[model samples]
Target chain A: MVEITVKVVGQRTRRLKVDPGTTIAELLRRVGQNRETVVVRLNGRIVAEEERLKEGDLIEVIPVVTGG
Target chain B: MLRCSFCGRRAVYHRRYAGVFLCDRCLIKSVERRFRRAINENKLILPGERVAVAVSGGKDSVACMHLLHDYCRGKRCELVAITIDEGIKGYRDESLPIARENAEMLGVEHHVVSFREAFGATLDEMVKVAAQRSTGLNPCTYCGVLRRSLLNQAARELGADRLATGHNLDDETQAIMLNYIRADLSRLYRLGPGYSPRQGFVPRIKPLREIPEKEVALFALLKGIKVHLAVCPYASGIHMEVRDFLNSLESNHPNSKFMILRMFDEIKPHLEAAVPGFEARGCESCGEPTSSTLCKSCELLQGLGLMRRRKNLIFVEPS
Candidate 1:
């Protein structure tokens, strides 16, 4: 089984490993993320929630922020 | 891979309205350039002026502070951070530290003003009281009005020439549409990027108004700026719906958001004569500038019985 790293790029970078080929949605769920509240970047590129991960892929989950 | 239109590098963002794909460097440059252009085109700030950026510790505000700091380099203008702690226990308490952290990182002076100190109660306490009294208004209504008022007051007291907020394109367009739906012409006129010098009120400037919210988020991440990711608990209601609706529409129509903002801009000038204007007055309670008998903050506090609470309530019970 291949492993991918999920790095939450928010207040603190919380890292976790998950099985490869995981959908961004599943990755968010495994990482305890709310899909509606964040933007997901797979490796260096922003991707859709349904995008699948590959082995050794780095995911950056950033919170969606608006106005002051 | 979508290549950046400017440079032959892998694109990090696809700006739909502009129909352009940009690499990280190009995107950041574009955002910065546009930010400066927004300020320069509108004459938002003059040389030798101080700008107080309202930092919420969120990516938008933190990123804004950093950008403004960069823009202030080698110039007579200065940038400072002003964070208002609304006393939202789980929400704001978590974000306040990051605000200070960002300010420190950017080497800008940071000042935190709290509702507890300024209004004699935290938002948590105020919300609890409002809930107890069955107040129909949402927390955001009171929070937004009071926060804006306090920001203006604090900025003015800090000797700032302008108070800058981190309102991006999505927020601006969503606000414009919401005002249209509610037929709030006056607020609609106030939704643009820069405010003119009004009597007794420090002008508010929004440099990020031309940038998309997602791009701003990506820009912050690319720059490694630390920001609070959690959304406010009271961010629901009609505003959220309007935001979502606009997002969906923009996803299909691409540039629909920009079109709406442009339309609003086109119509805003004509609205000046159409909408009835009010002469500014001073609040009877606090002497802050107001359009009515009492300023919004005082009126809100009066409704919440804070005016009464602010009085000396130290009673010696039959000692």
Candidate 2:
């Protein structure tokens, strides 16, 4: 099992152990994060909810925003 | 007498969908036909270009995606589905799943771009801050800026040749009214089914520009597309009131919206020649295309500290 740590900007970070084949959507729901209110970036690249996470990936979940 | 599902007026015409009825007046300006006409008139899709449909899981967008997919099939154009997740909590959450389902069912490639990591803020956060600072300003002003910026960037990054939206007749008319009210002739001139490509920017095409809102709803129903039928929680207060006023006027005068759009079309030629080029120039700050040194999206993002503010915000007077 690949251990992945999820960190959200302006929020707390959490770690989870899962198979490398886990999709971003499943990981987000597991972390008690709302999929609509945030976007996930894996290792500095924006990954869609349907994208799967690989081993030792550092994921950053950001929120959707608007202004100006 | 049965009333229309849309306006609750006397039902005057039968729609293709069962249990759906439209007034004779509404049937005349049906959304499907309007969309077909818009595409025909504007030459929105080419023979072999890959087109990306922007879906928001709303009726208009879902209808647009389905229509474009069906229309482009034999035409040899590829249709990909793109959705922008604005991170509006419950509002955007429910819609994403529906959009994905629609894309999957259609067997089109689907991509989603979000604002969370892109800007480090959510729609909810922005609205909260805007409410505190600018009490009366509309949230759409911000949402529109961000969504357009992110969508354009995402589409380009995804290698889409053209970006398609579900902006229908009512939206075009409302925008025309707002532009006229603000004397924003430049923007008014730019409003249409197609936006010409400028330097460093990809072109955007709207196949539903001439379709009415009601017709879009009908098309969605007839096509059996599941739409996220919820109003944006932030679209209340003054902005909703303005839309309500316009809708009431449109209800009373069935052709009023189309008439307004016609006026815009009539004036477009004159405005195009007179107005200086609305080309994309590299942003001095972010290197994106803009009418000025910095693009509007970057300017707004910089204002929120999501991006570094490279240049001072220049407020152009609507000439």
Candidate 3:
């Protein structure tokens, strides 16, 4: 299992271990996070929902809706 | 003409059982058909591309998603439904379940993205902040900018080739008026049924651009699509003023909306020539594709003390 870091916007960052073949959407949903509340960028590139993420991937999930 | 039970307006016919009566002026068939043709004419969607429909759980958006899903059946193109949760206390929560249920019933892929986690604050918070900074300006101005930016980014992440919105004829007409009121010539030129893809920006297409507001409601009812019938609370006082103005115009002229659209068509050539196409550039602060050195989304974040403000200022919209 590869270690991955998930940095959610407005929330603290967390690390997780997963297989390299996991889809981004699946990983997001697995983390008990609503897929609708955030957008994920893997290593500076926008990660598509169908994208299979690799081990040691640093992902930033940014929320699209803003208040102010 | 049959009078409407709710609004008490004279309609051409009564739908019976549904109890909603519509006049030729109210029926949206002609407008819907015209909009369909306009979308086809503009070549907004390719044969096999996937389109993400921005569903707002309203009559217009729901009808748009359903129509596009049905229209693309068995075709190479597929339809997906997406909703943006603005994090308004009671508004977004109520609409989300309805949007999800509609997507499930339609057998299309659906996704929701929220504002609280994304912006470090909810819309209610943002409105409070903005109000504290400046009085009189509505929260909708910020909300519209934020929602548009989010939808585009979310659609891109979803691998959608095109983004479809349910902006009907009335919306389009009001937008025209708003642009005119602002004297924003560039935006007025860009307002229409189609938007082409730019370097970093995904293309957005409006399939319901020609459909009237009333017809969209009728279509939703006839299609049996579950839609949130409540008006937005945030839309109660000020924004309703603009809508009431438009409604008055429609009531007096009946075909006023269509006439306004026709005016757009007449001015299309001039508008295209006068307005420059959208250019995508990396945001100086966040590297997002923004019209300016920094994107509006980033700007709002900076204003909210979330993202750092970019020092390099390129293009700024005149307020």
Q: What's the lDDT of the predicted structure labeled candidate 3?
A: 0.70
- TM-scores for every candidate against the unseen true structure: 0.85, 0.71, 0.71
User: What is chain B's TM-score across the candidates, in the order shown?
Assistant: 0.94, 0.84, 0.84
lDDT of 2 by residue, B1-319 (tens): 4466678765533332234656544553465576677777788877788888889888778878988887888688898887888888887899999999999998988888776656667777777776666645466777888788777766776677889998877677777877787888878887988986685556899888876565565455444579876678776554445455565676445566777888888888888776777666787876666788887766676656566232221122578
> Which lDDT tens digits does candidate 1 get at residues A1-68?
55776677654655556666667778777777655446777786765566667777788877684442
Most DockQ-accurate candidate: 1
lDDT, ranked from best to worst: 1, 2, 3
Give the distance in Å from residue B191's predicted Cα in candidate 3 to where it truly belongs: 0.7
List runs of model 1 lying over 4 Å from the truth. Answer: A1-38, A44-61, A65-68, B308-319
Kindly provide the TM-score obtained by chain B of candidate 1 when compared with the true chain B: 0.94
Whole-structure CA lDDT of model 1: 0.80
User: What fraction of the native alpha-carbon contacts across the interface, defined at 8 angstroms, is recovered by model 1?
Assistant: 0.17
- What is the DockQ for all candidates, taken in turn? 0.20, 0.01, 0.01
Model 2 chain A: ten consecutive residues of lowest lDDT: A59-68
Clashing pairs in 3: A36-B112, A36-B113, A37-B114, A63-B118, A67-B126, B11-B23, B12-B22, B12-B23
Task: Give per-residue CA lDDT, model 1, range B64-133, as digits (tens).
Answer: 8998998888468988789999999798999999999989977898888888877789988888888888
| Chain A: TM-score in each model | 0.77, 0.82, 0.81
lDDT of 2 at A65: 18
